[model samples]
Target: MSRNVREAVWSPDREQIRNMKMYRLMEKNGIADYDEFFQRSVGDAAWFWEEVTKDLGLEWFRPYRQVLDRSDGAPWPKWFVEGKINAAHNCLDRFVKDPRARNRLAVIWEGDDGEVRKRTYRELWTEVNAFARGLKQLGVGRGDRIAIYLPMVVENVVAMLAAARIGAIFTPCFSGYGAEAVATRLKDCKAKVLVTADGFLRRGKTIPMKEEADKAADLSPCVEKVVVVRRLNRKDCPLNEERDIDWDVLMSNRKALSAEATDADTPFMIIYTSGTTGRPKGTVHIHSGFPVKAAFDAGYSMDVGVGDTLFWMTDMGWMMGPWMVFGSLMNGATMVLFEGTPDYPEPDRVWMIVDTHGVTHLGVSPTAIRALMKFGDRWLEGHDLDTLRVFGSTGEPWNPEPWSWLFEKVGKKKVPIWNYSGGTEISGGILSSNLMKPIVPCSFNGPMPGMDADVVDEEGHPVRGEVGELVVRQPWVGMTRGFWEDPGRYENTYWSRWPNLWVHGDWVQVDDEGYWFITGRSDDTLKIAGKRLGPAEVESILVDHPSVVEAATIGVPDPDKGEAAVCFTVLKPGVAGDENLKRELVTSVAEKMGKALKPKEIHFVSDLPKTRNGKILRRAIKAAYTGKDAGDLSSLENPGAVEAVQQSSAN
Candidate 1:
């Protein structure tokens, strides 16, 4: 299969032809061009969003009379106020009623042990209904919070939908999170029920998730029951007869449950963002408009249609899970869910899943691509990837080498790389590259259909050719209502920078061609000798070096300079990290971004600390280097990365 895929790799020109077809589709859909859409989006934000929501077939119990109510100011802009709808209805019920979709595949789960599980929309609806009934039997109700601590299995998805079905706000904790992290979110949300699995497989090893849930339950007084799904047959799994319930037993006795009728503004989910400076903020997304916006962006921007199978490398804990599930299902598309590391068994495990399932749209992170690129094209030599139509990237800025490699090798340059940017607060992408736009490495084409995004200077004036903070001028459907139980914090965090505009915290620049480049986080901007520099600009130059696999730059306090640049780098596999390679990397950054922005210290590390969603935590690195406590290490995929950095700092 790998050989077949290698042979089918088309030249650059052939790839261009494929992209042209995607552009034609956009034109057919009334977006004359990417630029036209961008102009209309900023000029007529409300109208543009209304059109997108309607086109996505979002059915509201009470349709919105107005698209937005911004008279209250940007900080308090009310969206779809008069509308009433349920997110679960938009994601599941709609598909259940459609005959063609009823028999169509909803989720294709691939276990780490090579076991495959399939669920059709009809079957998925039944399971979700039963789960909802079980929650009700346990005294869970609307406005209540349910914490889910499970792996990437079908049950996790079912638990989420079931919670939404009954108007219970769901909060998912990454199965990899330790007991402390899980307990923090549980206490914050006052979760009444905790959903977990007995165990799960990771890299062919068993992880006892139920034990972690048990520990969390011990600390959280709000938890009334622990629902455990039997994933691995552990002989001595612990269970309390009073509070623990077997997942199968509960579902077997419950009947199909009806969807709860709720207001559009009702809280749907609380997704915690990896807060590097303090406690992780529980970003609250609501029902109705949030699902509609996700569906619209995935369908129109990524060109996902009914019959297409979408697969994104993500876990149940991340916002991408909700984004992928709701967007694909609401659009009547199938989703491929994998329950193991991308490079588990072999370097080509992801490609195998793609070919085996005939996945059409595959979303991944830049970190994953960088890792795959190090393995070279040989890993993907012969896989049948003709089914793939679009490639999506999110989480962080991608370098040109990995981007071009992904385009030329995996996509054969035929698929458009949809670069997306948004946080868990928004539920989905605010800015993204559309199929019709010209391809650029690590750049977004424009904002989503309705988003009014702009790159502005510190004084709030628009900047076209220089790097500045990214802000949205108007409110959109998927914007978060507030932080869970912390409306004051939400106001101060998001809306404080600009009066009503949302300061996205991303430092970005838009070229004269209108191609948007994200430099890094606004907080990561370094002031070296009074000159401001973004970490992404420096990291991009470092990654351009052949020996460098990935790099992260952070500003550390300096005696001479107000802040000096410190770079942490990871070399390609088999390449040893040495002083010579570090010198080359530092020199390369000086040549690209200027000597003033060059790193004062370049240290080699095995890996950089990152969230599960694949964002490098620069603030964490800064804290470690400055001999300060690293806050909120909960979302880190590799906790060892922090110790590695600390060891390097001591040296």
Candidate 2:
């Protein structure tokens, strides 16, 4: 075993006091061993989930008479049957009721202009109550959808909690999304109100979010009002009085209002996931068990506890946004919200925030780490990162180079690297690394405490030591109720493949030691001359080359090979992207996987098309290379990336 792996096995971090409840409860039950836990959790799912819900402290108005109501088939299984409790209540009310939590910091906002703002539990309650009153004034009621298109400022967090506080369903669009993308989500949810900002600062430049809001409003006729927060101090931003209201004025005279609890199964948010083949799907999450599960996972798996300042580089539009908000705050941990680009002013801006806030747990994407890796280790060598205990990564598969760099430099090789995997539908991580387990590079220790996850072959049989589809055998508290107004689509998308199991659309594998490795999306799996290959495996091999900075792989049609692997790569500085370099990359892949999986073509490019949340858009790359219309260019961080790839391919 490697030195890091040996150390992780010999000595794992002990769980803090506030984080040990779930493990203790699990031990109280028959899940004393990890192997036995995995077996029983998947084989006897109903009993596993029933015990989980209670151990996690999920609130329900009426107790679920049964753990699951699968009479309607797995596609439409009813979890927490006939239960009623508001998610906002579980996140906010419970925290406020704890006398020790009243004075603890709930959120800490750090602006790009070097301004810092802190809000305690008492203060956050007032802000949420006032914003909830404002939402009520805009005629938002139970089950109504409220679209939030704001920066990662304090107002954005307040808007989501406020909407949920009053039983309204909140849907957040990433501030980086363009008008059409925002319009599609708002129209799909039939949003009644939009909370936006006049503009926001990014890399010291003013971005006009209100303009996009106006264009989205023009497209979405269901939008009744737009609440605008003053972020950039814009004087002449366009505004419609009949439909647009100043956010500050809306909360000026509003008094603190009590939360109105709703049914446990009532929709809390409509999070849209960019589907591989179609437009984004609005996955609807509910009130009852999501908060408890998020909090429990953050505490137990990530080791976040009271007084710890946590910061995950994410926006409200992504799952990590809601995950950070409920997870950290519910455990009485202060959350650090950053409102600008991570590399603003300098490449070390994120490191500065960590040092400034004494942030204990830092969550970010692998893309961010890759970008920083290009700058060398000196950028973080002199910084004081002693406050950090754990580092979290998500969004995409991480390369061992960047993953190890994060551990050695930022963590001093002591802190645990908590690699988590799941989608917006699962609310938080279904498979995550726990504090008590050894964390290998780019691998999960195991499934979360209650999740019944497995790597299954095409025949629905368990597979060990080989890549297969990742599926959940049982339902958990945080699973999405269904896609909004698209029950048929949801059924066909998730449930049709594996009979009662929820196929999570990821290609995963389990080693003999039982550690899980995710190999990109299952839909992105390519059959090169009838042999299955995962894009992540090829990409990981490419990234291992010292000359390569980043890489993305996709399958393009080939008359001879049926479907051939095509790789696009961005080289490190001073590394020539010539014919010899291309041949070297192909040779590397051939040696790593096999000659059968060798790429037919290797195209050098400046960048890859990725979402604002840092997920590479593999479908866009496939469509671009195949001459198919690249659908929905709205979620891309660099729309020009596709054009660049096309130009390079032609050359």
Q: Whole-model lDDT, candidate 2?
A: 0.82
> Deviation in angstroms for 167 in model 2?
1.2
Clashing residue pairs in candidate 2 (N, C-alpha, C atoms within 3 angstroms)? 61-84, 84-264, 85-264
Ten consecutive residues with minimal summed lDDT in candidate 1? Answer: 1-10
Candidate 2 structure quality by residue, lDDT tens digits, 233-330 = 79989989899999987787557676665766778889898775568899988775567667767876786778798899988888899899988877
Candidate 2 to truth, TM: 0.95
Clashes of 1: 10
Q: Candidate 1 on 1-651: residue-level lDDT in tens?
A: 000011222223534434543344445457755567567766876776776666667778787777778886676666676787788777777777888778999899999988999999889899999898888889999999999999899998899999999999999888889888999999999999999888999999988888888999999999999998899967789988989998987697456677887776788899887665678899888886567677877877787768899999998788888888888888888998889988889999999999999999999999898888887799897889999988989999877778779988898877778889987877787788766545666777767767888889989999887788899887777888788888898999888877877988988877776778788888888888987677877787788787788889989888888898899999877898888887888787777667876789999899999877678888788888888876788888887898899999899
lDDT for each of the candidates?
Answer: 0.82, 0.82
Could you tell me the lDDT of residue 125 within candidate 2?
Answer: 81
In terms of TM-score, which candidate is strongest? Answer: 2
* Model 1 clashing residue pairs (backbone): 1-382, 1-383, 2-381, 2-382, 2-383, 3-382, 5-382, 5-383, 6-381, 74-500
